[model samples]
Target: MSPVRRRALVVTLPFALAWAVVLAVFTGLRDRLPDPLATHFGPGGEADGFTGPGAFLSVASAVLIGSGLLIALGVLRTRTALRAQRPVVAIGYGTAGLLGYAFASVLFANADAVRASRVSEPVWQLGVAFGVACATGALGWLIAGRDTAPEDDPEGSAAPARLPLADGEVATWTRTVGSPVLLFGGVVAVLVGAVLAAVGPGVQAWLIVIGLISAAPARCRVTVDRRGLTVAPWFAPWPRKRIPLARIERATSGAANALSLGGWGYRITGRGSALVFRSGDALFLRLATGREFAVTVDDAATAAALLNALIERERGTSEQRG
Candidate 1:
């Protein structure tokens, strides 16, 4: 089978199997387990909080199934089959092992306990779960294997473009782009956080933090000049990403989806680093170090042409000096 298909399975199968095992084990432990299992423990490892079997299992399934599907989607949807794999695989297996062991331990802890209050969790089991996670993580990394460098990715070509420039003449290109998706997501996250604070988990504060960070820069400025490309949030003077002319090998414009570079925002995949506020037309740069940089923006063609022209001008001046 194709490697991409294999990678999807490699990352996704572990979570499914883990969830299945949990279900099977729980079924066998029905009579032995307390009706309301002691799901939470105190610092001393004594049972402090209780939950029904259905509720505990639901939470476990959500954690395992939801995360697995998300990672699988990321792996399957990336533009290149040569995308980074080791980290992705490691995270998948590590999460599966950690949660799997924790869930299993909880079930075993409640086993034969006549009542929830009588059950006690072994604090040492947390350490053991981490150890198992680390070992399984290594296994996943081995399974994912090596991947080709970004320079070898077959997604698209980087044919250089040139803007005719007279001697002593210079040009610059600039544009501001915004992502509605980011703006919407930020607002929703904050609202959800607020609602959750009133009705659900106390982790709502994190959601608010994420929302603020995401909403702060839905719009960013993309500039291409003799200095090379610079990207900065609209509200900040300090640019988030910058690529100097000396480091760039060439510039090109291409149709690229932000997701292809791996989930939005600034992402570094096996293909390259990208500042993707949104997806669509983008300016691409192949660096002197054999790495790539990309940013989604309108008028990307103009930005790419200007960058390429400036590169040629620099090369000509260097050759004359030599």
Candidate 2:
């Protein structure tokens, strides 16, 4: 194992120990907890749900253990597989810490409540908890730092050669892609609404909003013209992306994977952001700000080549003017 990986593991050790301590403390105090613990609290800081102490502890333990193991496994796998795993490991450890602290605080608070025979207001300061976790993770990542440079994608050279255009020529291309994310999100929202309805009627109003978002058309129109690249859903006018030619540093065509982009649908990955609809070749852009952006669409090779040509042409025009 590399020295960096060793450091990462060491940095995460304290958090794991913290989890263990919290679990042990809560278990020792289990006998002191009330018969039916106030498991859920409402907005007004009142008990809304009750569960046996055993069930609560069981669920908490399972979530904590499962999540911690998954994150640790992720760090190990990513460290072995990718050159840059600092961000991934850091975020994972930080999130684990955040969850551990949150659960521990909850358990302790409820125990106190049971002993005192009084309702427990939510004592966890979500902002502070999250902030501390994120800070710790960021620190670990900074300490671990970048281990190696990212390897070149073997298939990146497969992009089509830049198209040739005349000095005054203006080119345009158009393609449409289906966005299944809305459909999927819509289905999930409807299911959630059904579950919420069973719990209470107050959540019914949010169902309408979810329904509208889901029912919207799933087609996105992608256009590349003299005005640069424009991507917008066919059904919406205001929500669109217009990347001007000047801001684009480079364009390439490559296969996109949901796992790499962390589950797709306008995802923000460590490298940059992606607007992915399906897994296939996509037009990737390196912006002047050194950020990467991508959009998955059909015939990405042609788009990438044309985009390169256009960028060169724009720069050429400016050079001639000077």
Candidate 3:
């Protein structure tokens, strides 16, 4: 087997085994349990039958296990593609499974009675199964999704030569200017404050106004050019601070744990050393000066590959000259 296939099988095997075990236990329990609703409707309830908790658990386990396996298969098959695209596809499959269950429930099950009871036993069972499957699938994708080598440029152009920074050239990391989420939140807050101010005049109304002003978006930027690295906040009257690139020890991409990192406006994390633009991935720059800078950009892997290529070219040129 190819390395990719081997890796996929290894990761998926344990989960599959666990799922089967759980399914067997659930089935056994369902066959042995007595009907709970039997007392409610007397003898009629006995005739109506009872679906045990084990049945629900079995369904959930199946969904979770099945989804996980499918996600693993997807990763194994699409190992060379871009990282961001894989999750979307895997998640889509999980979502479809949930929708399928919902459709079945609506067509054949008593959805109104389920809702009236407020128990949602079936939905919960199916959701848990679906969620487990999706989570495992996502995990599989993350573990096996990386490409060992940089993808070739589609343009088929020769690689560019890297020019050394001539004494004063600098490298910096900075945040992107403007955040749509912060702006939207600020606008909403301001509108709410205005409404409160118009309704009544009091200390609380002024407090709302203050809160609105304080919540306004703040901008920060990092720039590196011929001069040096500079970091400055947007919409602020301040001088930019210069930082040298030689101080940069390493740069790596940040993983998005929550959708928050890649959703609605700018999100800064990793101790504020990284910034991700509206729905963009983060890049971390570890400087020799013991400071880190983070910037969010689109297609981080491609950028990283290009930067690595440039660095290799520069090193080669230096060696040839010496």
Candidate 4:
């Protein structure tokens, strides 16, 4: 294994082992806990539903342990040797860390409830769990580093040459792509919300929020201009991504299959990050830093051509400055 891969294994396995130990400890102490421990809380922090200690332990352990094991397997089975697979390893370890912290939060909350004989506010417990998980994830990122590489600019890197732009000249192209995945997600969320509404308003409210968020990426805009490339969802602009023309190394048009990219909607895969909407032509961007990004949108060929022209102009300007 490469040094990077070894480091990833080291960073990931500890969290898995730690969570395993925690599960064992919790199981040993289950007798002291209440029968049917309160697991879910309402909006006002009251207990919503209860599950037996055995059931809760089994379900939580299965999910957390299962995720950790799957990550380890993927890392071990990856075909590339020199390639670090840093994002995969980091995300895997980070998710395990989050699950570990969440499991601890549940344990502590239930421990307190068992002592008091009542379910108190789980909001604080879960909030703290989230904070800790983020910190743990950040630590994993630090260990793995940025995981970016420079693209090898072999011949035929750029899209077929377009009319070369004059120095300081500007051009732009814009298009919108609708996401079927987002639509499907919204539908599923709505259906789940309706089903959960039969239980209680508080539980259903969570699903409603999920549905709204799921619909946010229903349509996204792609803009390529002198400034750079921008990908922003129609529902919000603050979360947009901008790639300055200077950073882009190459541009090409090709198919954007979600299956190859490992699902869709703001995906991070073996290639890099992408705002994937559909399984069709996309403008593929290779940055100077070696990172890759793709935007699946209509009229990708024009976008790629215009982008390449701008990049060439930017390179000429930079060379003159040097």
Candidate 5:
């Protein structure tokens, strides 16, 4: 089976089915449930917080569906080594089991409660949830079996993008790139926080903080010179990431989506690591360790070409010495 479809089947189906069953049971007990369901528990297990049934259902759906899609799509998009794919598949099943057990436990605890405050949960049930999660995760791992690793570029190596450079010639290319989507999301979050302030000041405060952080665009200066590639934040250049020319197998340019690269910021995925801040043109580096590193930026083609030329020059100098 194709790896993408295999991962989708192994993860998505179980996750969807688990949530579907939980929702179904919750609906079946609607008549028995109070208008406001007990959503939180005290130390002694008495209910401490409440939420409207409709609102609770809405939040549940959003969490389940949103997270499930992200997981499924993430697995499908990136190519993975067999070793990395194993844990990803297992975690997928375990997550579904954990979420399903927790949600269903709440419904059963709140069943037929005269008042939200009177609801109680046997804390032991939390242990059961973990047990169930472990079993399901193990099953997923077993089902994953042994899959072959993904294939790389043909011709035994990537054909590096090149720009002609003469002896002693030096070139440096730099660009500052930022994510508009992050800015948009931050604005929306702040607006939502304002609305939530009426309900709970404590929660609204955190939401506002998160919105501010998200809204602030992150800019990085991408530089390619004889020293290879360097990425430094616009705010501070002291802390920067660099890829040495000796470790780079090849450099190329391609269009990369932020989500497919595992969202904004430095993230590790089954395929490789990425410095994702936006979704657009990106410089792709295949390293000697068989892992790829990518940086999203404008004018990536120029940067990639410069890197290829520099790497070739370094190789020629090394060959003559040998």
Candidate 6:
């Protein structure tokens, strides 16, 4: 009934059940294999290059189960430190070390076999290797990338505390638009051609006019106020979305990765919604209307805390009114 016990049960019980199920299935399948298949891999068959179905299953199970066990063990070993609220730096280092070892083991064991295998074309092989490397590298980075501890800032103090403002008021946010030369030139050419066409006409002039119109610059803007948020991309018309603080459900902070949430721009994931930009820190907002708003901002943790506080205030007001 303690927090640690509750956390341990939540984390370990399902994992243990999953492992048991996996082991049961594996054992059942192995037991059902015909004698011939089981015996196909004779003594030292792994090194002898006798890779039959049984051998494949054995190797697959070892890799899968071994990796899972390693991860579980790591988590268990670090659980105490994590509960003690240790800095993330140590956890990241430990994670990176474990993943690095796992990746190295896989590469050393089968690199040659993978290179010689004809099941996949060279391009496919390269793609698989590249994908694995990228995954491993990303995991390593996430675990060991940056230390989040604030040296000067005291613990429990608001990180870069928000500047004082009028009660119940929000500050405006602004983003500057880039001047696109190509777009401006095209628009000017088209307008000139249109004017000329009204006086005198030619096919070349019409073509020029069309080209100019098509080359117009895209419009983009970033707007923020006391109520909520708004952002418009250049190529498409901006949606009239203004999320009031009263309607926000929750706000959470997470990493910005394309694989995790598709390619950044205005993605709707199963968890909620997000309007992600290509770069910078991201804040995910779950709204009461079942929409999610993903925003890129300078200080994400502060923003999330502020938003959460605002939502709590709104709820308090509603309850009081009722």
Query: Per-residue lDDT for 1-322 in model 2, tens only?
Result: 6753664465456457657866786787787677677655556556655677778767776766665664454344332323344555566558767777766666666774644335565544666678869887876576546545343351364654588888778789889988676576767677767776677534555875775565453578888887778888786765788899999887888776443444435667667777777666688888899988888888888888888899988898889899
TM of each candidate vs. truth: 0.74, 0.66, 0.33, 0.57, 0.71, 0.33
User: What's model 3's lDDT at 241?
Assistant: 48
Clash statistics: count for each candidate: 0, 0, 8, 2, 0, 3
**Which ten-residue region of model 3 has the weakest summed lDDT?**
37-46
Comparing 1 and 4 on TM-score, the stronger one: 1
Candidate 5 — which residues are off by over 4 angstroms?
Answer: 1-10, 42-46, 70-91, 122-158, 179-219, 254-264, 270-272, 277-281, 288-291, 314-322
> lDDT values of the candidates?
0.79, 0.67, 0.44, 0.68, 0.76, 0.44
Candidate 1 deviant stretches above 4 angstroms: 1-6, 40-50, 114-120, 146-156, 166-170, 175-219, 255-264, 268-272, 276-282, 296-299, 317-322
Residue-level lDDT of model 4, residues 1-322, one tens digit each, is: 7643664465457466656866876876666667777766677777776777778878777777666665555444433231244444455556776677766655666773554337766567667766766676666656555434332222233445565677667678888889877788787888878877776545676776888677778788889998899988876786788999888887887654443343457778566777767666778888888988877887787888888888888787779899
Residues 147-250 of candidate 5 have per-residue lDDT tens digits of 56563321123345798999998788888877666777788789988876655424456777888777554667889999999998677774688999999988
Clashing pairs in 1: none
Q: Give the C-alpha miss distance for residue 100 in model 2, angstroms.
A: 1.2
Q: In model 4, what lDDT does residue 116 have?
A: 32
Model 6, residue pairs in steric clash? 92-143, 273-292, 275-294
Query: Per-residue alpha-carbon lDDT of model 6 for 1-322, expressed as tens digits?
Result: 6533443343333234434544554455543433223211112323212245456445545644554453444333332322222222233333333333332333233422432221212224334545544554454344332323222211122332233444576556545333243355457667767665554323137656654543532234555454655556555544434577767776665445332332234455444555544334556666788766665545555666666665665677789899
Clashing pairs in 4: 149-290, 150-290
Highest TM-score, which number? Answer: 1
> Where does candidate 2 stray beyond 4 Å?
1-26, 42-44, 54-88, 112-117, 122-128, 143-146, 149-160, 164-221, 256-280, 288-291, 312-322
